[model samples]
Target chain A: MKPWWIVVRKEVLESLRDRRTLLSALVMAPLFGPLMFSFSMQTMLKRGLDEQDKPLQVAVMGKEHAPNLVHWLESQGLEDVPAPKDVASIPAAVRDAKPRLVLVIGPDYGKRFRAAKAAGVKVYVDSSDQDSQRDFRRLDQLLQNYSSQTSALRLAARGVDPGIAQPVMLDEIDVSTPASRAQSLLAILSYFLLFSTLIGGMYVAIDATAGERERGSLEPLVSLPVSREALVAGKFVATMAFSGVSLVLTLASFAISLRFVPLESIGMSANLGPKVLTGVFLSLLPFVPLAAALLTLVASFARSFREAQSWMTGALLVPTLPIMVAAMTGMKPTALLMAVPSLSQHFLIARLLRDEAVPLTDGLLSAGGSLLLTGVLLVFVVRLWRREKLLG
Target chain B: MIHVTGLAKRFGTVEAVRDVSFTAPDGRITGLLGPNGAGKSTTLRLLYGALTPDRGEARVDGLLAGPEHTEARRQLGVLPHGAGLYPHLTARENIRYFGELHGMSGATLEKRIDELVAMLELGEAANRKTQGFSQGQKVKVGIARALVHSPRNLILDEPTNGLDVMAIRSLREVLRGLRAAGHCILFSSHVMQEVAALCDDVVIIAGGRVIASGTPEQLREQAGTTTLEDAFVKLLGSETAEVQS
Candidate 1:
């Protein structure tokens, strides 16, 4: 075997036997993302389904003044509950979320209806309250339907066509498929994958560099006939192996866990079947070297194992920045954007999950960009390893 | 044989090694004796190619000893100060790792590891991880690892710093066995008795400069002292007194 390969094999064997490395690389990093993702996604899907299936209840004042309106609301699935005795406390009650929402029909509502004038109704709701806002939307839609129905009746009684009231009706056609609709939520999946990739190689990188130095084995190791470049290459390859394994395990876990989430109930689906999973893994394959090199480079600067661990923890946040920016700006993958490492992988992953074909140029740019940056970082790491101060 | 000629090193404003030169010939043990901070480690580091000297060169078997010279390093085995083993690796595995790195593998590497285990009397501990090994066992493993490659020259920097009495005795026996096999052994120490007992030739350094060089008896005669320890103290005392004046 070559010198670098020998070094790589030793490092891999040593790290594999280490319990801390195994726990982080095999267990914690791979499971944390999928478990948290699936649990939260299931909760979100359940809440959405419940909101649509559950009845909307509202407290009503002056129900007698607008008995017809109340009747229309009940037909539209709004349950009418008795209002509080004091009308002045309605805002406080809404703010306190006692009834969640309150609807008040003014005393003049009946007179206005008889006079064919517009009757005013007040909806008391705290807009800042998320659940109250959802209930308020259902109640508002019911009220609007009642008003339109009454207007149509008035128009028909006057021997005029009620159709004239609605001009230029919007016929909305949804063009998004379930997979495409799910892309927004699954955009976070790329971040998790990238994060776990960095985490997978973290301890290995620190162990090979800072941990070796701290243990005082580095002096003997470096004093061997092997070149510093070979030693560093070996360490980098071992780290990449760990990160790659972690990336694949995380992808598989996500694929299996997403099945239990009721994405279909929310008009979305996770396209994480075998084919998509393989595609995502391939798309993210080039990122392993980049993450390994990045972690190794940062760890080589640390003087001790504890210092390297803290620095690696900070390095874990690097992949998230690009993903966060892409999500916030709604950035689409262009030729230039594809040349950015983590961002390109995010865009490719989102595309793969949406069952869209990744452009060949985009794929090449992403892999090439990540590998080129890896080369640059490897140069820095090798140089750092060659320095006499590396023994520290 | 190992030869170092006029080596000088500077760490920022501190001249860790102002000037150093020494040679340890084959079939003999040479001790680089000095007080702490006397540049013994720095000199060994330069000789082992871990550091570059500012004004001199270290040569092993006629080849320049530096980071760029892999062939020179191939002929040298170095046991550095406070050497540590990988806690997750067994004693045999630790020895085999260095042997493999030196381009030895297969049955040869395994045989060498077995030999080291028996020579050091590692026994069952050779198959177990080094994490909870005693300090003596750890040092034996370190020495075994350094010798696995069977280099012509060996360098040890403060190898007996933390060893107990028995460990030190066993370590001395190991060095004596290597010397009998015609290997050039160079080691550094601040202990006067250790040098007087083990070294065939002694080079005394104080303030990064070689103050005296001879056998223990010769050094005692040169310092006009009855004992080697008294000679060492007198030589260092005069060096400090000269600096003060």
Candidate 2:
């Protein structure tokens, strides 16, 4: 047997017996991503649906000044309540009612209406509050209707045509496909994928390097007749095995669970058929070897398993950061983005999920760039293993 | 034969081994005797290519030893200081892992493993994992791994330090057997009696330099003392010898 194969065999044999590593690679990592996706999407959709179904409750102050407008609002399903005596307490009253909005009318409301001027009215609700958003939009539309109707009546009284007052009308057109629209809801898939690829091989990588040192066996192991390259190569191969298995398993679980979600209701389809799964899995392959090599390098420099774990925990953010940044900014996927590691995988998976055929160059750039970086990291780790201080 | 010529090593500002030279000829048991922190482990490490000497070279079987000395290292079996057996692997697996690293595999490896296991008498624990091993059992496991490859030379550091009397006696017998088999064996120790009983020639090291080297009786005659312990103290000219049991 090749020297490195011996090392890999031993590592795999031991890691298979380790319950913690198995739990993370086979069970926890695969299960968590899909379950989290289903629960969060279900909750968000339920909240939006419930918000639209609820009655819009509004508190009207100085009702006599705007009785006609209030009657119009009531006819449109606005359940109005008498405003509290102290107008200053309107914001607090809105908070107490929870999701109910407050509408305040000033004393000059009657005068402003008679003079054919803008009415002094204030709407009290937290704009940042998610549940109050639908009620806020309803109130704004109601006031706008009242203003447009009054303007038309006044224009007719002056013997001028209301149509003459109108200019070019603006039309809104959305060109988003159902799959593209679902991208926002399914953005989290890339994060979990990146996480699995980065963290899947971490346990064995640390155990084979830092864990060996802590156990005091590294001295004898390094002193063996085998070249340092073969030893490191063996370890890298073993780590990649675990990492590959974990990445595939997690993605499979995520793809399977996505099918059960009621994505169609939200104008989205998560049909992770075999074709898309195969594409996603292939695009993500480059990251597994890269993650394995990078993790081994970091763990090799550490003196103990505990120390390696600390460094690994911090290092995990490197792969996760790009996806997070792209998600937060809602950045559109560009051809250039396919040249980066984690970011490129995110874009490729996004395109595949959207049922778009990815260009061959994009796939090559993503895989090639990641492999080049991994080569650099592998050389660094091999050099570290060759050092005498590696026994620490 | 293992020949270390003018070997010197330093870590930062502190010199571990300075101008140290020695030779353990074929079929002889040579002892490297030193006080605590006297560079014995560093010298052994340099001989086996675990460390690079800042000056000079350690040649194992005529080839200079260092990280690039794979040919020379293949002929050497080393029991490094504080090398622990893998707790998750059985005694046999631990031995086989190192044997495989040295290019021993299949029937050859299995045959060698059997011989070492029987020679060390590691019967029941041979199949059991090393987690529950006693101190003596652990040392025997280390010895078994070191010998599994059947190297031409053997280097062990403080092999009997933590063993009980019975274990030490058995270890001494094992070393004697290896020496009789024509393997060049060099081991380091702080205990005078252990060296006096096991070594054919004793090399006394103090402050990272060789202060004396000769047969046990010759060393005693040169120091003008009857006991090897008193002779070691006299040769070093220090009251801090503090010979271990």
Candidate 3:
């Protein structure tokens, strides 16, 4: 076998025995993203389904004054509970309420209704509370519906057309497909995937360069007849192997975990079945080499294992920056955007999740761009390895 | 044979190895004896091509030795000062790694490893992880790794730095066996007793320069001293005096 292959084999064998390497590459890094994703998705889905299915409950004061309004609210899925005795404490009562909401009817409400005059009511709620806002909005809609009904009846009684109240209806039409709508949530999946890819090879990259030097084995290894290029190439390939395995495992975990999340209830389905998983893995495959090369290059400059580890933490953020930017700006992918490595992969992943056809040129550009950078980084790493100061 | 001529290397302004030259012939043991910070390790590094010389050349078996000369390196086995083994790897695996890197594999490599284990008396340690190995055991594994390819020449920089008396004795025996096998052996040390006990030729260096070179008996005779230690001190003292003057 060639010298580079030997180095690769040795590195792989050594790293496999190391518990830290195996934990990060196989267990921790790959599982972290998928598990967190599934848990959060389940929580959001549960919250959404609960909001729609459960009836809104409100503490209503002066129930007798607006009995008709109370009946209408009950018909509109608002349950009335007994209100506080003192009207002065309504704010504190709302704050103490389960859903933190209270409805109060004025003493003149019935008189005003009988006289066909404007009536008054109050809804006390804490806008600062996030969980109560949904209920508040539902209660507000019910009151608006009751007011419109009363107005329409008055108009009909006067022989005026009630349809004049709504001259122009604003019917909202959401054109986003279910898959495309899911893209917003699934954008995070790309970030996790890219993050796992870098983390997978992190220990091995550090171990191969800084760790070896610290262990004092580097001097003997470099003193051998083997070329520095072969050694570096071997280490790089080993790091890529770990990163690739991590990517595949992360994809598989996401595919499996996403099944338990009720995305359908939220009108957002994750396209992470076997086929999409395979496609995503392929789209991300090109990034493994780049991740490995980038990590190894950064680690090569580090003087010790601890220093390498600290630098690598910063390096892990390099590929994620483009993804974060793309997600924030909701950047649309153009042909030219494919030339940016991590951002291009993000676009491809987004397209795949949306079930949109990925252009062959975009795929080529993304893979080409990543591999080109890998090549450049590998050259720089090899040159760094050849320097005499590298022994330090 | 290993030959070094006018080797000079400096780290910024400090000349770590200044005008130094010596030769280690085949079938003989040559010790580069020096005091602490006396350019011993730097000289060995230059010889092994880990560092290039600023003003000279190192030749291993008639081939110029530098990072570019793989052929010359192929002829040498080096055990750098304080060299370490992969703690996660067993002693045998560590030796096999170097053997394979030297392009040796299959039965030939395994058999050589077996011989080394027996020769070094590594015993069960050969198959055990080196993480908790004693200092002596680590040194043994390091030497075995260097000797895995069985190169014609060997260079060890302070191989006995942290070894116990027994470990040092065994290490000396290993070097003597290599010399008997017609291998050119060159090692550096700050200990005069070690060189006097093992070396056939001594190259004494002080402050990055070779102050004297001869057989232990000849060095003592030249310095008019009864013991090799006194000769070393006398020569080093004279060199220091001359520098001060």
Segments of candidate 3 deviating more than 4 angstroms? A57-75, A79-129, A139-168
What is each model's TM-score for chain A? 0.91, 0.92, 0.86
The per-prediction CA RMSD against the true structure, in angstroms, equals 2.5, 3.1, 3.1
TM-score of each: 0.93, 0.93, 0.90
Q: Which stretches of candidate 1 lie over 4 Å from their true place?
A: A61-67, A80-96, A104-124, A147-168
Two-chain DockQ for model 1: 0.77
How well is each residue in B99-196 modelled by candidate 3, as lDDT tens digits?
Answer: 99898999999999999999999999899999999988998998899999999999999999889999999999999999999999999999888999
Q: What is the C-alpha lDDT profile of model 2 across B1-245, one tens digit per residue?
A: 99989999998888999979989999999999999999999999888888888999999999889988788888888888765788889999999999998888899999999999999989988999898898888989998999888998999999987789999989988989998999999999999889988999999998888989999999889989998998898988742454321
lDDT of each: 0.91, 0.86, 0.90
**Looking at candidate 1, what is the lDDT of residue B21?**
84
Q: Relative to the unseen true structure, what is the C-alpha lDDT of residue A196 in candidate 3, on a scale of 0 to 100?
A: 95
TM-score of chain B of each: 0.98, 0.95, 0.98
Candidate 2 wrongly placed segments (more than 4 Å)? A77-85, A88-100, A132-138, A149-168, A327-335, B238-245
Report the C-alpha lDDT of model 2 over A205-234, residue by residue, as the tens digit. Answer: 998999989998888886788898998999
Per-residue accuracy of model 3 over A75-151 as CA lDDT, tens digit each: 88887777777878778867765537888888899999989998989888988787678789999888888899899
